[model samples]
Target: MDWLTRANRRIHRTLHARPANGWKPDRFRKMALPPIAPPGWWKALLRLPRDHYVRLFTRHSSVHPPAVGRCIEVAAAMGQVLVTCDGVGVARHARSWASHQTITDPEHTAAAAAARKASAATKPASVEVTELEERSLETNDRIFDVIDDGLSTGEGLA
Candidate 1:
């Protein structure tokens, strides 16, 4: 501190031929005030589009049913909700640890099972490639080959 202060004083005195007082006008008085807000200040903020999902992540920790419920409540208050938790606790619990383990939600499990059942019942439509479509795909592949060849040869078609 002493060295720095001495060097600073020496530099100031050498440059300006005077000791540095390090004093200035009141910075508070020179500060500018923020501009006034327009009439509908929260219009943009409050405007919500339809069909949006609120994603909440519980990273690396398993949440019990009550905690999950609370999270869901908060998310629901915001909008459409989806709460996700990423944890190895379930696997660990399954392996051995049997004390103070609150890691299962029966209702959520049942809902997931039902969703799986419904999904399995609904079969996806099979897609068939037409002759013209196959030719177009081949043409696209050739275009990529041409692009790769041109780029490798430095012909500037990349």
Candidate 2:
């Protein structure tokens, strides 16, 4: 602070032909203080109530009372999630425990249902592929023979 003050005093200003210290006394009183922050300014830094949730597509993902119990157990195991003995504080996808009624966002539910229906129309059924038995190096000989035949017949390039 002393070094800065001494430096400020030493440096001369070309406009007034004087050091910075000479201008400080005149300007100091007139300078306005910084604006104060509004009440609950710290709240912006924190996670809001709505933010703490594991969202799921209700159309694809179903949730009953039994699933809520499983969710609480999973949340407890995961650690950071807010979990009580009764239910999980996270995930808005589930039904209310008291009313036993599902409380999904209406807009989101409609959108998910539409998307699910669209995908189902286009998507193929589950495909099952059988594993092939390991063959000897001789299996590649057939491919090489075909390549050699093509080259010999001038069908390789032209």
Candidate 3:
């Protein structure tokens, strides 16, 4: 591909150039395998040959996996490795491979239940009898004042 020349060069320099072995057959074979593309480029390239890119650019473009595979091969040759989601370099959602067991303490559970029952049974001390008495007095005074003010006088006529 037209964009592949720089990548090919990088691959040759990183993988093929071995001063010690001078291009061994085994090394070449290993390098021939496809490499993982950079995450950004890979994701972007994956959108190609799809309507997303075509609609954005208002132009038709076709992409083949072979080109991407070649790029990956070149990257692999250059010792560029792909990191899995769990790898330190990769961003991943929080996950646990192993199941987790929640531990419950019998004594603590019993204590909590007992406390809840005790609170439920308690009537919050009934707002103190003195406070209730004061509120009742206030309400009676208001009623008496309303009666004296002639607002309740209309009831006699009715």
Give per-model TM-scores. 0.25, 0.21, 0.20
Model 2 weakest 10-residue run by lDDT: 41-50
lDDT of 3 by residue, 1-158 (tens): 76555554453565565444544766777754458654431122122222111111232222222122222111011222221222222111222222342223344345546666887998876555453434665587586775644565656655
Q: For candidate 1, which ten residues in a row score worst on lDDT?
A: 42-51
Q: After superposition, how far is residue 148 of candidate 2 from its true place, in Å?
A: 44
Show the lowest summed lDDT stretch of 10 residues, model 3: 68-77
lDDT of 2 by residue, 92-129 (tens): 33323333333445554555566668868896879999
In candidate 2, which residue ranges exceed 4 Å CA deviation?
1-102, 125-131, 134-158
Best by TM-score: 1
Clashing pairs in 1: none
For lDDT, the strongest prediction is 2
Which stretches in model 3 have alpha-carbon errors above 4 Å?
1-101, 128-158
Model 2 clash pairs are none
Query: What are the Cα lDDT values of the candidates?
Result: 0.37, 0.41, 0.35
User: After TM-score superposition, what is the CA distance of residue 142 in candidate 2 from its true location, in Å?
Assistant: 24
lDDT of 3 at 13: 62
lDDT of 2: 0.41
- Predicted structure 1: lDDT: 0.37
